[model samples]
Target: MEPVPLAVGLAALLGLSSAVLEVHVGQTSVVSIKGQQAILPLWYTSYSNSRPFVSCLLERRDPTKHLQVLTYIDGKSKVDEKYFKHRVGFLYPMPSPNVSIAINNTQEDDSGQYMCTVNLGDESSTDGRNIGLVNLTVLVPPSSPTCKIQGTPHVGGNVTMSCKSLSGKPSPMYHWRRTGPSFQVFFAPVQDLSKGTLTLTNLTTDMSGTYICNASNSAGYSNCTITLEVTPAFNAAVVAGAVVGALIGLGLILLFALQMFVYRRKKKDVQEEMANEIKEDAVAPKTLSWAKSPGSDVVSKNGTLSSMNTAQDHKLYPSKPPSDTASVTTATGSMVAYKPPYNNPRGGTLTPTPSLSSQSLPLYFPPTVNGIHCHHANVPVHRNAQHRTNGAQPQAPRQEHTLPPGLTSSTLTRMGAVPVMVPAQSQAGSLV
Candidate 1:
């Protein structure tokens, strides 16, 4: 039992001595810039009197496994040419307690946990205590940020000022401040530090000026500037009123044009109606005038002097007889014989008989049996003796008269003037 207790005590002492020879790391974390060098520190204390064979290795710790970065064995050093190549090497010669390694030309992909393991000759301690850990971070400086203004910079409107960096390690923080004479450090505007934005509410003209944004991280800082200008608000009411007034004026003009069009159309219609009435009146048939007595003068509606022959006058008034003494009577009436005086060779007028003189005669006579149209007031009455006989009356001779230009027989009849057959001899100074 005493021997068993001594063996256990000795085993515990050996484990303590081995633990004292384990590797120790300095600075659990390290930060460096890209394209620079990084150092993973490892050291150990010697417990034995004589020199011991030291073998060490540096590995990168991954989520799945550990990757060999560098190795030292038999006083020789070798790096994983597949990954680290010549960029990774031991900082000091082997066979010493210091087993630190340097990684030159570090990149972003080199940022990860690194471990250093040490082993003594023929003493491989699998207890996992002879190892050192270091976390490396390759930092990238903040780039030059871009400043921009968003939203309309009008009075009483909300606006946003933004700052952006194309690349930065550990994400840069943003700070916004106004520059120029209006700047005040304590009066910094409200901003989102993570998103690099500054928000302004209810903007005013006084806020117009140069603004600057600073993006900073542990590595370095970059700044950008922008100018803000707040303009006066637009007057929408005035524009609307002007537009409405223009529309109203245009409408009035159109309405006036429409009224003018309608008035012209109505005026044209009235003129056409009046013209049609005049045309109807002109085309209407003229009525023949009725004489009250044979001695009465016939006048047309147009006030033209007109006379009709006994045949036409009797047809209109069958009970009346013509007043002319030379006119032949019907079987129911008595005829008054007329004897014309001889015409004077010097064109002197002959006295008419009382019975013929009492009758009103037409101003002009139709053509006589000699085919001569004569005026009662100008021509002398001429009688031929051969036209008369005792109790053997000759019929009156008919004559045709050529009407004046533009006058037809129907037009003359409408005017109450008709040609009639008359005796060649008439009462002296009496119209035939």
Candidate 2:
């Protein structure tokens, strides 16, 4: 019981002595700009006779981690070579009560909580106020921003204007305004400050102007500018009318082409028909006529007498007169009219008679009279030869006849000789 009371009294005394030594640092947070320096103020009070050991540390409140910044023991000081290195140093030398530190060339990543602690030499006491805290902030100004317009800037339409900054320490706020043709400045009705967007609805020609966007933060601000142009809406009636007119013109052109093609085809057909008709009319029928002989009568092999006068020949033939005529003397001393050489209507020349002479007579005469088949012996015509030699009257040759089995010459003459109907041959201009 006596030893326990002594231990209790010793613990009370130690607590009282530990409470006398304390570490102090600025309570307010420090603000800094990037690429500049910042100072952390620190001090301490100690009742002990000897100097105290001090330590400075960095605390990350977000991730809840601790890092050693520096430590001071005795008269010598050491900095964390890996983390602080040349970037951090004590404002005051070692063995001094002040343990303030300055950070050079600060960056955004260096901003965080820092702590200072002091301990008496070899005390190992837990009951005391020997800790201090500080907060630091590094600010970065807003960089140059880009301005853009989205959607069609047309009358009765809507559009969106946007601004953006690539870098800033704190997120920047945005504002939008427009400068008219007369240089009048006005703010947009619909805009988002944080998102950096401005919206314009039911646009008009009056809305055409230069637009400005400003991005700002605690450090500084930057701005960008763009232009918008609105135009009148198109007229629906005029567009429709133009389209209809073009379609009508195209239809007319197609109709004209079709008509021309049909007209050409019909004309060609008519020409072909006319040509066929001309070819059909070009052919004419051929006729045959028996030439008349004066003061002579034709006798058949049947002892039939057929006398054909000029009137009777024309009545029987009833065809167009021949174009050319020639007189020929027969072996009986009679002049017979015949056609001369001429072109046949179809093609080729008519079969011409051979040269007449006293030695030979025609074997077959063309255009026989009344279907009579009369044969004359090849007796030389004495009249023609005699006439040619001495120009004297020559005697006519005597005719011989082979009478039919049932007919006589006297009976044939009394009955006026059966008129032989000689039909024309089928071939054009052929001789028999």
User: Each model's TM-score, in the order given?
Assistant: 0.47, 0.49
lDDT of 2 by residue, 366-426 (tens): 2333665222222223222343332222333433323445556444433333223221122
Candidate 1's residue-wise lDDT over 1-432, tens digit each?
133234345656777653344556767898888789998776654454333343433344555545677777766777777768889977776566666778999887788887777767535555676777888899987899999888988889998889999988989988888887488432345788888889899988898888899999987899999989888777445666889999999999999999999999999999999999888889655443443423224322222222333333322221211233333221223333323432445454222212222233333333344564332222223333345322322323333333345656554334333234222234453234
Task: Compute the lDDT for candidate 2.
Answer: 0.63
Total clashing residue pairs per candidate? 0, 1
Clash count for candidate 1 is 0
Question: lDDT for every model?
Answer: 0.61, 0.63
- Best-fitting candidate, measured by lDDT? 2
